[model samples]
Target: MQTRSKTSSLLSAKAAAAASPATTPRPPLKPKPFLQLNKHATTPLPIQEMNWRMERLTPPPPAAAVAKVALARNSPDAPKVEASPLERRRPAAATVRSKQELPKNPPVNWEYVYDEIKLFRRMNSAPVDTLGCGILASPTLPPKVFRFQTFTALLLSSQTKDPANAAAIERLKTQLPGGLTIESVLEVDVKTLQSLLRGVSFHMKKAVYLKGAAQILVDQFDSDVPKEANEILKLPGIGPKMAHLAMQFCWGINDSGIGVDTHFHRIANKLGWVHTKEYDHEATRKELQQWLPVKYWAEINPLFVGFGQVHCTADHPLCHKCPVSDMCPKKDFKPRK
Candidate 1:
């Protein structure tokens, strides 16, 4: 009985131990090795590695230093760099010149001319707008009448003075059956026309031309003055100067071509705007157009014509009293006492 009781107690103890939770076993702690405090032997790193480290640490050089380096590279003492053939062949930037530096014609003092024109406009009151050229003067007349009258006046004014041309135009206007209309001019006999135009220059020849011009207008252009400058040139006795003037006065066409007369040519030459040896009107016209701006086309003819009449005459120009005397170069001038 004692042995059985001890065996039962041992079994109960095993069951209790098996039912309780099991804990993991702890790891063994490692022991640290001993160290000695000794002085380290000083030694340099590889040259490349040391250089790389120094470069990484150093700051960049300044802009002035970089520019000096570039300039030194291009200096004569520096080694020459051979350029490629193509690079050597390439053109450099072209040097452009101003018009003033390379002038085509004798350079005009345009500022002085403009100032002189303004002064002439103020000082001289010679009825340039109203009575200088009778053709340009009578714009108030009827369109057809204006055209015919202007043409007739230009024809009569070839070598005639202003007052005499005015008188001739007046006589023809009153004496003609119906007036200076194309029909009236055509109706008047050549003999009667010559009588009426007796005061003007080239009266006899102009009388015949008047009839021919009237006939041409009647046959072609429906008795109306042509708008085209070329068409006006087709009519007998209508030259470039007359045609351009007529177009400006009658149809208000300007700036296409300038009217170059003796007075205009003289004034332009005298002002040194044109440099032509020959006294050719057409050549002077082209030269003036090349140099002078387009705006001066219309005003130049009338202004110079009026000025030529009063101050800058063909025979004896009044240079002392002239407005542009100080500025003008005064080519081929002969002063009058």
Candidate 2:
């Protein structure tokens, strides 16, 4: 009976304890020192803990010694390495050449040269002075006929000396029925014309040119030479030199251009009036027209031609006796003994 009473009392005390609630609360848990959080975790970490973790995990900067060495290498006052012999001997980069500048003013005083030439021409008379194609035409012919004769003389003068050309013109004037007029040149057969032009250079070829030119003149220009320089150039055997000369002598137009022949070309280059390649008369003419005064155009051709014939002869220029010797550059000239 005593054992039964003790067991009943113990059972009653356990039931009463199970029914009662605890008053005291449990403390919060501390995280482990080495614990790592998952990178894809849903839970957010505190700001201070996240900052500490970032600081410990980041890569460090370059070493101070390495940075100082790099800075020294790039410094301006650092010693330079010497180039090899081959590197030093290597050709420099090719530089572009600047375009040649056109001269604003002529090199020499042209008025002084012109005056000297005029003086020299007064003492010496060249074949061109009397026997030139300009004067070879007959004064007895009609105005239109006279111009035609002048044109014919110029055609014959090419590659032939003045004396020979004058003789040829005289023969044509006396031999041909109409005396070198457009009708006479057209009427004469090529062979007969060739025979008449015996002393002229390329007489046979010139005969064909004369006949063709006469036909063109009759058909196009009404048997008269064209006044325009461009129209005159359309004729056979007539070049820029002949066209310009015709304008000056035939039409009395002086400002057309400077009629540059071999003599004028050589002297112009020798005097340093123009810079052009040898035998480049066209370039010489352009350069002269660019700088030369318009007032001197009419007389320059005759003046230079006469000077070239006497003192400034092509093969042997008389440099010692030249009136403008002091002013002349005498380009490419060798002192003759």
Candidate 3:
């Protein structure tokens, strides 16, 4: 019984020990590894672009730097614009140049001749338009194939409308019985020229002029028209104005003729280029010759003639639309009421 009882106690103690919770030792807890960034990380944006650059360029205090840039963009006290190297160079040249060479309204006076040339800007601008455009309207009036032929064309042009001149020219083209040149005119007699140019302005008188002019061209200058302005002026009926205009319009000589037609004289007197008691075309031409650059002198005739015919005229002028009106010398000029 004692042995059984002892066995029973041993079994009970074993059962009890087995039933009690057994504590297993946990593995030693290791500290977590520290976080490490890449070799060279940067902000998502670049530091050199405009916004970034401005920000980075700010002085020690970043807030103050931003404030400076803001003040700079908005400041009324800032200079108008950065001066160019050419602007810096101009004063030296201006001081050296003679006053006669420089116009008073230098900024707005490029197209004007010496002091006489005036660019009349348009007023009452609906949008934009010009009188200068009328001057350019007759580009096709004088045909290019026969540049020398322009002399004859000009003869046809006097007192005749452009279309009339064109019609006369077209008719003459068919009747090239003579070649419409001095040599050609010399080939045919005065009667033939008069007949061919019958409908053109002053046909009979022009034929006489043609015959006279042609003989001079043949005897003195050979068959060719003279290119030099002075040499051409010597031809009969070819005055300085005509000679210069012919050289320029016919042969593309830029500097020469004083283009003083009735229109030019009228416009000029109106513009105050020459104050003359006579207001004569010839006198005005001579007067302008002194002031305008030899280069720009010849162009004035065509320009004024064109301007007069189309825009400013003997009748009602479209002054509100005149291109050079702001600086016009005409007595009629007044601010539109």
Candidate 4:
């Protein structure tokens, strides 16, 4: 009877607690400690201790200490030292080369050279007959016939003395009634023409070339010279220099090409305007045209030829009296007085 009474009292107490509105709250959880990725040891350090150690991490050695370490290392014991932050970073000055280290052929002040040519030309007499110059000096012929004459003069002039070339041209004139013309040259027997051109350099080959070139002109362009550069280049014994000379002197075309003869080539190389060991005129002509302005073309050949003949001769140039000696590089050249 007593046990049944106790059970009934316990049930009544549980019911009273279940009916109550207020209850106890749960405790807050603690945050997990962070582990560093760089930590390598098996036993992990506590968060506070690890953070404290990170704050006091070792910094890079001072410059003096680095120097001492580098000095200590020698021979096979020399360690490959890593570059410092400053050293590893690119230097600001590296982007541009120093003025002293720049290419040897500095930009040419062409105007200065142009001024020199102008001054020299004004003071000097007319240049000696280079075949092209001689042809240009002739009394103007009819346009229809002048091209052939100018071209032939250029062909006959190569390696021939100026007097010899002039004499040969005079002989050719005697062969033809009017003047040296396409029909006149072609009509003359090759052997007769060769004999007339006796004093000229390579007369035999040149005579044959002259006849063949005139024949081509008559057949291709009706005895007229073609104004186009490509067409002019197609003729026998005609190169860029000769064709261009004809264009300028005969056809009144200017600055279309540069005529580099032996004198011009030698003088240009000496001036440091061109750098080449080649003794060929054709090669020098191509190289010089790269830097030489078209406006200067009219003056260059004349100035060089005149200077070469009078002052800057092949074997012994008169450097002491040369007008532009102060400005000339005089490369590979030693002047006599």
Best by TM-score: 2
- Which order, best to worst by lDDT? 2, 1, 4, 3
C-alpha displacement of 327 in model 3, angstroms?
3.5
Greater TM-score among 2 and 4 belongs to: 2
Give Cα-based local distance difference scores for all models.
Answer: 0.68, 0.76, 0.54, 0.66
lDDT of 1 by residue, 1-337 (tens): 9999999999999999899876765878875432211121123446785576455434334435544544555688976655434223221111111212333453534554555565454345443444555344366777888888888887777667777888888887788887778898888888988889887878998899889999999999888888888998888877788787777777788876788777778777676666655568888888778867777777778877767766678887777656566446673376565
Better of 1 and 4 by TM-score: 1
Ranking by TM-score: 2, 1, 4, 3
Cα RMSD of all models vs. native, in order, equals 34.0, 36.9, 24.9, 29.9
Q: For model 4, where is the 10-residue window of minimal lDDT? A: 91-100
Measured on C-alpha atoms, candidate 1 has an lDDT of 0.68
C-alpha lDDT of residue 225 in model 3: 68
Q: Candidate 4 — what's its lDDT?
A: 0.66
Please identify model 2 stretches exceeding 4 Å from their true place. Answer: 1-104, 335-337
* Lowest-sum lDDT 10-residue window in model 2: 91-100
User: Using lDDT as the measure, which candidate wins?
Assistant: 2
Quote each prediction's TM-score: 0.65, 0.67, 0.53, 0.63
